[model samples]
Target: MWGREVHSHRVLITIRTKFMARDVHINSYLIVATCGGKAKREVSLEELRDHIHQYYIPLGRQFMVLFPEGGFLHKRREISQRFAEKNNLPKLEYVSLPRAGAMKVIMEEVGPHRDQAGTSKSDDRKDNNFNQNNVKILDTKSGDNIEWILDVTIAYPERVPLHLADVVCGFRPACTTHIHYRLYPSAEVPSDPEAMTTWLYDRFIEKDKMLEEFYRTGQFPPKGNTPLVTRPVRQDNVRYFILHLFFIASTFIQYKLWCAMWSCIW
Candidate 1:
């Protein structure tokens, strides 16, 4: 319901925990991709399509969070640098190169459904796939097509990012984080694979520069600091309590229902 970007605290949880049910209940869907290979890209695209058809179409979710870096910036930076060097591309320091195939899958499934009509735009490309998935998503009550791609840049103080464990365990003290936002219309994003890759790289390059400036000046855009990073850190105790209470109540209700049915059988 909230459209305009607001300064809000975030929750970070790792998937390795025994919280699979709660994780899947949310709209988050994970795609397993290889660090290097030709087949991994195709596999990731397939997984993305399946996830979109399952949850995105039914739930009518528009906003998508994609980490083009493939992994954490710290972990993948060296690999990205090596790949860039080998390919004679720009060597990024602050951010890793994002995957273009993922963008391709998203735009293809959530594109102009009526206009494309599965019609092939180019000989190299196959079907546009603008029929079933888009039709189902459009039919949902809360459903709407994707309109904007938000290029969010999150900068950690001193380039020190808090991990899932760090956030959950309070390993680090509360520190102000700076975030920058940019948006582009979906139409502005390239649909062709080659163009799309270039476009994504350009965005990340810009992001890298922003991060560099943020590290130097404690703010993005190389301008004076904004109140966006000056807000007081709010506590998440109330939210955690409510979430836990809901989980317990739901489990108890399910248990009672199961008991009632079993009593009749016995």
Candidate 2:
């Protein structure tokens, strides 16, 4: 959706499931993690970083979404909570504890370096351009560094169908998917592994609270108090218009074909 809106490319970091890996089309733009494989060994952060550098960085992708929670299942959350307790980390309520190793690696690998003034050049550039046209533009492709890390939390108001068949068959109505996002300047992120880990954990704790508020009140917590700050949602109006035209043209052709066939049969 963002890719369409911004006219930029996207690459996904997904689990290396057999079904996904086998499809050549889907596998091309993905950095597939080997967590679900029979080996049960997870891919290292360095390896993931290398993969992104080699594939996605060159393509100039504007957004690379990473789910540090790993998995969304209740069992997975329980395991994560137990692990957090053992590690003396805060236990989250609505979200799983974020594994920060990958995030730290990503920040170090792609985050901007500080100059003599302890200020990031990337941040400076962004700030200089902020008031030019009332357009917020963060450059992520000037070189290797990513300017921002968008922390997004998604929630379903009602029960979400887990199965693909149910979704494809339209089992649910047009339900609203609540999304909250907060953009973290890459320069602001800690370089130290432990500090970065703590930082990631704190973010998840905030997400847990936001989810609690959402479920209780059916609305996200306000911007001032909430860590999940809202950004204006961008709609791809042009893309939708093109899709509408395509649908109408296809229906017209199908109708004409059906009428011709019926006439011949009569």
Candidate 3:
């Protein structure tokens, strides 16, 4: 679970147009885009890039999360497959084709490149010169590049809730949600558009396989081998104990008030 209190990083989520109305007030950092609608307006890559460079980057934000598959719908998956086939892209099983337009633009805009000081040596080596120049120029003041891609895969062993209401109303019982995190260095991500597209798909392919293994065994591959690491229980034990006492006292007071009301009514 992503708790804002634990991790202080600001979040920006991509949500469908239809679901946008449900919690309109909670749209401080959400990117709303229509899905399969006639008058759908896609989020512009230029706008997103500008926003990051101007706002997020200057503020020194470390992470930006993007769901390239858009939405996890079966129909969308079918459409993505058709598009991939037409473009001669690899067929993916668990994930849909990533919309490379924004990703490509973002990478070109923010991906790592040699700074002016580092580029000076490239003139000595003819072969290295071409490769150095190929890297896109960025106007970052700190000269730091987006170096890591944290690929997070979340899995619900039980059936996923159909709606947010199901979760709020506690319709679904306690289910095991497994999360696996992997960090890919900048060198691993290709800068070329076509290669980057394939790279994104390949990451998802691994996720698909991991999910398959999870469903089959109800445990991730590393579960048995790796020891579970968790936050110290003592950190919150005192807070929980105080809350438990408050709950008991409140219930007793409420019960007494209810009995007094019944007697008066009688």
Candidate 4:
């Protein structure tokens, strides 16, 4: 399995997992769903950690999806702005400040061993032990560990975000949904909670700028201030690539069928 720490939805995650992950010659993967926020029962760190150990590591799931923003943009914007104001942090209008507790747990459990790695000595936040009375279960090995953190910023056509209901009910017409990706080595990520919080804040701030540009110009700017080195997209064997199109189609069909069955059962 290619370890990925990303923020993504299920159907797309399924496709990416099929493309990047396999176990014992099988192209299959599992998803673990966890919630954030207080309205829907504030999830305890211990419970969240247990879920990862209980489902993800044991089942050998490839992707651990996280919505570090904790809630939808509209729902959390005011709260985030207030917190930012109180903390003297930059007021981010486009992206919400990320909650770092869950991120911290996942990284420590599966990224690098605490014994091997120490908390970052950065001045962003005082060096602190956030995870206290920690009892870890995941066997952290070179073969089994998170290697990449994919920061995926999804931009819908016309800056309108779509919901699962829209996709399920066929209310919205098909349109191009642009996704910009910035991948970070998991090793490069700060291990400690405070440093990780600062890291997430920095990422969201960058996202805010990207999003503002996207909304204004109708296209995401090339990553950072650097010039884009343009190259033609590689086209694989036409016959082989045609087969992949069929495969992707089959996945969407399967997903629709599953949704239909689930709706019936419920």
Q: Write the per-residue lDDT of candidate 4 for residues 1-266, one digit (tens) a residue.
A: 23443332212120111011111111234332224445432345445555555556555666666656645677667888999999999898777776666567667666654446543222122112232244233444534567677787776776667777885566997676666777777777777677878988888888888888988997778865966443334435698669878998999999999999999999
Ranking by TM-score: 1, 4, 2, 3
Off by over 4 Å in 3: 1-43, 87-90, 114-143, 159-162, 222-266
**What TM-score goes with each of the models?**
0.67, 0.61, 0.59, 0.64
Model 3 weakest 10-residue run by lDDT: 17-26
Error of 3 at 261 (Å): 36
lDDT of 3 at 186: 59
Residue lDDT tens for model 2, 121-191: 23444345332454422234433355666676777755242346654555755555667766666766677
* Candidate 1 regions with alpha-carbon error over 4 angstroms: 1-37, 113-143, 222-233, 241-266
Candidate whose lDDT is highest: 4
Cα error of candidate 4 at position 37, Å: 5.6
Cα lDDT for residue 146, candidate 1: 54
Point out the worst 10-residue segment of candidate 1 by lDDT.
Answer: 14-23
RMSD to the true structure for each prediction, in A, is 8.0, 11.1, 12.6, 10.5
Better candidate by TM-score, 2 or 3:
2
The predicted structure with the larger TM-score, 3 or 4, is 4
Those runs of model 2 whose alpha carbons end farther than 4 Å from true positions after fitting are 1-46, 114-143, 159-163, 225-266
- For model 4, the run of ten residues with the poorest summed lDDT: 14-23
Give the lDDT of residue 77 in candidate 1: 77
Model 3, 197-266: lDDT tens digits are 8887777667767667767887555545676443322236588679879998999999999999999999
C-alpha lDDT score of every prediction, in listed order: 0.58, 0.55, 0.52, 0.59
